[model samples]
Target: MPPPARRPVGTVTRGTTNPNRLRRVDRWIGYALGGLLRSAAGSPVVVDLGYGASPVTVLELADRLRGVREDVRVVGVEIDPERVERGRPLADPPWVDFARGGFEVPLPAGLGADARPLVVRAFNVLRQYDEVEVWPAWQRVVDRLAPGGSLVEGTCDELGRLAAWVDVRRGEDGLATPRTLTISLRLAGLETPSVVAERLPKALIHRNVPGERVHTVLGALDRAWERAAPLASFGARQRFVATARSLREDGWPVVDGPARWRLGELSLDWAAVAPS
Candidate 1:
């Protein structure tokens, strides 16, 4: 019946971001979580925690969700006050706005205590935190989610070409329920899908070792990419598509179909990629 305990704002991130750098994840959220937004009981609040220097990604998220559910709202939370100030000029009232906060995911005071967000899209935010610090941060965010809400956190390269993220939901017990690990790449010049290793979320960054589940996933994905070489003439897109299909055929528990694969994205159950 009382308010949740508040946590001090986290440290400022590197604050490096570029236009379109997070387009991959943004598009994924729109297509993947569209149904969740539509069925939301009340107003849906989506948070873009640690949206670096530009508010472009948060704005893009707002735009994407608005296209599906007009009532969707987006709040861009940054630890740097200066970043918040710089992004305020672009705020668009009740739809899209920015505030200074951190992993604590502070909502505007006006929303009242129960205004838990429906989605918290945190990219490149936890990269700086120690791997041991990830779960607690995840708990802090997921604990604030509305029922059926999500906490999507990950890392990506500068140009937005390669990305890897973990999509987590909260359980009735108010703990994380990790669902999937998604790796998206630009197939044009992609040498191998495993190149996404450099962009793994903090949770799996160090876990890409011989004995880790993430390592096993990446290794298998790379091999699958190689075996799909005969499909090259069809196009890199098809090659990646077949690889995703092959992964499922080989019993990797890949969670998506060719529709997402054609976009150079592949998703597997978190248990398949989480540190073992």
Candidate 2:
């Protein structure tokens, strides 16, 4: 049988990433999966797939993930050979390297045939693709995971203040399943939870309509935020916490509590907000 068709490779993105532009998402990753990162025996590999023109985000991700696992190795993969060539000089530590590759995630052979990556963070990589193409793209990436691995695919603002992503896991059946949806906003500037509608992953971006589960979830979040306005007297953080708490009370299957809410993050089961 023939392999799946390779995705139509696209042009280089603007690749405009600042040092801290992805901090919010990185922090969430560290918090959400630190244990898995720390437990990998021999330097676990992590991929920053589609890291654009600048490799700064990849470097930053390495620095952050290292806090939890000192031996973590990060490979910044770019589809553009020129970008990879440009980033090579910046590879200081041997563990952090830049490679020219697409979603296939090519790595050095001796790293261990069993060395599948624990995490693949593909941020801002799918925003430009047709919404219908996302699932297959996600499947391609998830299929490359090591056992008990995760693929985090999402989009965030240039500065990372507003973002949303879906966590895909390689399930027992070898199929990737969306496990959770996470939204992080800058509470102070948040007018409504739906403001983040623009940052949803490609799979659900087009599903934000009247009867879709994502739309309903956003609507519920907006109403809960409005109902919690009384708590705004304390601060935007307080209001957000109250709002998340309310959603939990209303049976939205909120995943985290006040601690995570304080960071302007809300996570729910994928089933709760996935397109229906």
Candidate 3:
């Protein structure tokens, strides 16, 4: 029999980006995985996979994670050699670096195996691939994570106002499993919760059909959002908080509460929206 098809190693992305366009996701990463980053025996390594035309996001990620892990090492990986070379100048401060690599996440010698990365953030990367390719792509990346490490893959609008991602972790048994699915939106402009369906990670983007799990989750979110409309008289923030709270009360297993919801963020068990 033929061996499994080799996963694609690297491909150039559209290279679109803007500073702070990823703040919501970065904030969530800092909150959810900060402890693991801080607990690394030495400086922790983090990869900003497929960082686009500019290195601004990588710099920002380093700044954010540094608040929790002072010795965090952030490497911005780009498949485009020119982009990688262009970002090299900003790799000073010792704690940050830039390299030409793709989903395989090639790191320097010292940072491999026992010192493998603590986290990999691959936003807006897989959205360009066919829906069927997302699972193999996810598996390839997750397979390289260090034990207890995490892989965050998702997509956000160009301006970063709305986003959704899946968190996958390397289990003790050495298998990768989806842990949670999260959505962050700019509530003020949100018409319906379904607007975020456009930004679901590649894995679930095409799974938004009428009877799919994702569709049901969005339906629930829209209902909760509508039920919270009265609170909009106070502010969008209040309305979002109420909606998130309503989701939790309705058995969605919402992850954070008002503090996170006020930031236009909501996370639920992956089971809630996994393709079914």
Candidate 4:
């Protein structure tokens, strides 16, 4: 007789999902990890953990990544068996697949010796857990990463207009450390950059209060946005560029330059907004 199946780690989410809802993060990954994918040997796997209710995002990720690495494989993982089945019809063999798993990030059986994923995008997954549960969850996912791989985890609003995520990598000591915090916004009608406080990753969401580094950063962002208002006549994108420049000028350690800033996105060293 076959052995009993082991249960997947982590809880099922609310299953909320939508098409194009993950475009912001997908675009960021294609830009941020492009070189990593290009330099990897053979095919590199990417896991869309907790892809909740649909595989649209998985399909989208594969489509975007193929532009960077033609052989990139994408696996959509969920703890819910029904969601897995729901996505199977769209699976395209080795290039794109659906699996039933959680933070353990189980890969397909017999997927060669280098079966670990190079990038694990776990968006909107941990918001349902207690804040204390986050680090353990991150560690579980990070443990499954290939050398030099990354675990991108965060939360976003329903419409995907506002989003924030942490790029976590394994340190030399084998511990997972968040290396950067990034905020992406739809600047067309954006009122204040601090509005992202509502969509911050679990690690920093609650930390967006006085005495916390995250709070301090968001406050500075709001001030910068207001100061850049005069540039709005040039367009929202230009105004956002100015906001990003202002942040950098104020010694905020902004990561990217005008090219990325025009996309209404900004990334800062994790130390800048890590919880106090």
Best by TM-score: 4
Of 3 and 4, the candidate ranking higher by TM-score: 4
The estimated TM-scores of all candidates read 0.95, 0.93, 0.93, 0.98
Ten contiguous residues minimizing lDDT sum, candidate 4: 106-115
Residue 113, candidate 3: how far off, in angstroms? 7.3
Name the runs in model 3 displaced over 4 angstroms: 1-8, 109-114
**Local accuracy by lDDT, each model:** 0.89, 0.85, 0.87, 0.92
Candidate 3 residue-wise lDDT at 120: 96
Task: Report the C-alpha lDDT of model 3 over 1-276, residue by residue, as the tens digit.
Answer: 979634438678898999899999999999989888877787878999999999999999999998998889888888888898889888864588887778788775545555567799999999988887777777778887777889999999999999999999866666678999999999886778779999999999999999999999999999999998888889999898999899899998887778889988999999989898
Tens digits of per-residue lDDT for model 2, 136-172: 7788788888777899999998888889999999878
- Report the CA-based lDDT of candidate 1 relative to the real structure: 0.89
Candidate 1, after superposition: displacement of residue 20 in Å?
A: 0.9
**Deviation from truth (RMSD, Å), model 2:** 3.1
**1-276: candidate 1 lDDT, tens digit per residue:** 999755546888898898888889988988889899899987789999999888888888887778889988899999888889988998876678887788778887656677889999999989999999999899989888888889999999999999999999987677887899999999997888988999999999999899999898889999999999999999999999989988899999998999999999998988897777
Give the runs in model 2 whose Cα sits over 4 Å from its true position. Answer: 1-11, 109-114
CA RMSD per model (angstroms): 2.6, 3.1, 3.8, 1.0
Ranking of all predicted structures according to TM-score, beginning with the best and ending with the worst: 4, 1, 2, 3
lDDT of 2 at 219: 95
Give the local distance difference test score of model 3.
0.87
Worst 10 residues of 1 by lDDT: 4-13
